[model samples]
Target: MMKVLLPVDGSEPSKNAILKGIEEGLLEGKEIHIITVVPGIVPVEGYILSPHVDDTNQQLAEETLTDAKALLADYPNVVAVTRKGDPGTEILHYASEIGADLIIMGHRGLGTFSKIFLGSVSSRVLNHSECSVYIVKS
Candidate 1:
């Protein structure tokens, strides 16, 4: 079975990527892995602000994965995962670990800068992924 890696961030583009993949018949008969990476919170002045921050981030990551999974309800071979780290790095690591045949993701995500041609995470993945990448634009 073909292994496809899909990284989402609960962004509209990311959701659209899933929808587009389904519409294009790209996810049929494939082992689809849906992942969401929560960026690690950095400490300031050698102290973390609040303990609940990590928990909140983790919850959000899981929610993101759940939402993505909902889009692929008909797909039997689907797995959802959550990771905490740099988004691009974690995505690449997961893809390599799974020996993915393809990576389908959005061209842009929920980032501060919307004017850029492509989101930083997507750009990094596009430039470095070992497998074929399909970028969906919203």
Candidate 2:
């Protein structure tokens, strides 16, 4: 069975990718791994530390993965996870670590401004991914 990695961020487009994957039977009998990556903010040495930074990020990541899991409820052999780091790099790393054959993700994540500010995650993943990458535009 093929291993498909679905990296999402609770966006409408990401939801569409999951629905499309299921409707297209791309997930049938395949191991589907749903992932959400939260980019963690690095603090400078002199900055005042917020004790809740990690907790907030962890919560957001969990919430994002939970929503993705709900969207993927109909798909069997599905596992969901969340990570904290650069989304593109994290997704690529996860794909390699899991030996995934395919990477499916939304073309846009969270907001357009973020994509504009930090180059598109999909574009970055496409450039660096070792395996086949499928970008679903919402």
Candidate 3:
């Protein structure tokens, strides 16, 4: 069976990507893995913030995965996972671990300036993934 990795971040584009995949029948009879990554917390001035922040991030990640799974409820071969780290790095790692054949993700279509300032996760995965990547633009 084909293994498809879907990385979502609770964005409209990500939701659209899932919908498009279903509409195109790309996920049928495939092993679908849906993942959401929460960035690792960083300390400020050598001091860490309250633990509530971390809890909140983790909760959000779980919620995102839950939402994605809900979208794919009709698909039986679907797995939802959550990770903590850089979104692009975690996505690549998960895909490699699962030996995914294809990755379907969303493109936020950030402006050049914003793209430069805030690195694009989709671009990173596309450029570095060992498997084919299908981008659903917003």
Highest lDDT among the candidates is held by which one? 1
At residue 129, what lDDT does model 2 achieve? Answer: 90
Q: Which stretches of candidate 3 lie over 4 Å from their true place?
A: 46-48, 109-119
| Candidate number that wins on lDDT, 1 or 2 | 1
Residue 99, model 1, lDDT: 97
Error of 3 at 103 (Å): 0.4
Model 1: per-residue Cα lDDT over 20-102, one tens digit each: 99999999999999989988988799785898999898888888888888889999999999888999999999999999999
Give the clash total for candidate 1: 0
Tens digits of lDDT, candidate 2, 46-103? 8986879878878878987888888778777888888888888899999999999988
Q: Which ten contiguous residues of candidate 2 have the minimum total lDDT?
A: 110-119
Candidate 1 vs candidate 3: the TM-score winner is 1
Candidate with top TM-score is 1
Task: Write out the backbone clash pairs for model 1.
Answer: none
Q: What is the C-alpha RMSD of each candidate to the true structure, in Å?
A: 1.2, 2.4, 2.8
Q: TM-score of every model?
A: 0.95, 0.85, 0.89
CA shift at 6, candidate 1, in angstroms? 0.5
Clash pairs (backbone) in predicted model 2: none
